[model samples]
Target: MSDDCIFCKIIAGQIPAKIEYQDDDILVFHDITPQAPLHLLIIPKKHITNLNEIRTENADIISKIFTQIPKLAFQFEISEKGYRVVNNCGKDGGQTVFHLHFHMLGGRHLEWPPG
Candidate 1:
């Protein structure tokens, strides 16, 4: 884990987050700043810098994260109306945090051609 990464701190229990779901490989939590009525941040407990950093060895963890998203969507009652899964790449992609993470957005009509 990166010494200065905020997500790492959260995963290591150095910080407090409104955790939603957690397993050996992943952690799901409510976004501190919600863009939708249902906004969840799904991340892997193992630190990954970003999407570009994903490699073969770590691919399974990424897959596990996807496998959990739908379940979380259902748990948060957003699956029926559908939801958006987003992963911002870099600074240009609006990824303020360097850790690899996905944002699950639902509970409202998310506009097409998002910013």
Candidate 2:
């Protein structure tokens, strides 16, 4: 884990978060600054700089994260209405944190051309 990464800190128990789920490889939690009524952040326990850094060895963990998404949406009751899963790649993608993570948003109608 990256010493300075906020998500890593949270995973390490150094920081507190409204964690929704956790396992040996993944961590799921509510977003501090939510864009929708239901906004959750899903991340890997392993420190990955960004999507561009995903390697063949990371496939299993990545698959687990994606498989857990729908369950999370259903658990939060956002599945029927639909949801959005987002990954910001770099600074230009509006990613403030470098650790790889996905934003799950729902509970409202999402418009096209997200900024």
Candidate 3:
């Protein structure tokens, strides 16, 4: 994990967060700065800078993350209406956090081609 990564601190319990789900491989929690009515972040425990850095060995772990999204959505009661999952890759993509994470947005209608 990166020494200064906020997410790593959250995972290590060095910082506090409103966690929704967690397991051996991942952790799901509410965004401290929510962009939507139901904005949450799903992140892998192992620190990877971004999607571009994901290795072949992490393929299964990546699949596991996607597999868990639906279940997490259900737990948050947003499965019926729908939700948007986003991964910001780099600086140009608006990635503020260095650690890779997926943003799950729902609980209301969302416009396409997000700004």
Top lDDT hit: 2
Best by the TM-score measure: 2
All candidates' lDDT scores?
0.92, 0.94, 0.91
Q: Write the per-residue lDDT of candidate 3 for residues 1-115, one digit (tens) a residue.
A: 7789999999999999999889999998999988899998999999988999888888666898899999988987999999999999999999999998999999999998798
Error of 3 at 72 (Å): 1.4
Off by over 4 Å in 3: none
Per-residue lDDT of candidate 2, residues 7-112 (tens digit): 9999999999999999999999999999999999999999999999888988788899999999998898988989999999999999999999999999999999
Q: Clashes in each model (backbone N, CA, C under 3 Å)?
A: 0, 0, 0
RMSD of 1: 0.8
> Residues 1-115, candidate 1, lDDT per residue (tens digit)?
8889999999999999999999999999989999999899999988888999888988998889999998888888888999999999999999999999999999999998997
Tell me the TM-score of each prediction against the true structure. Answer: 0.96, 0.97, 0.95
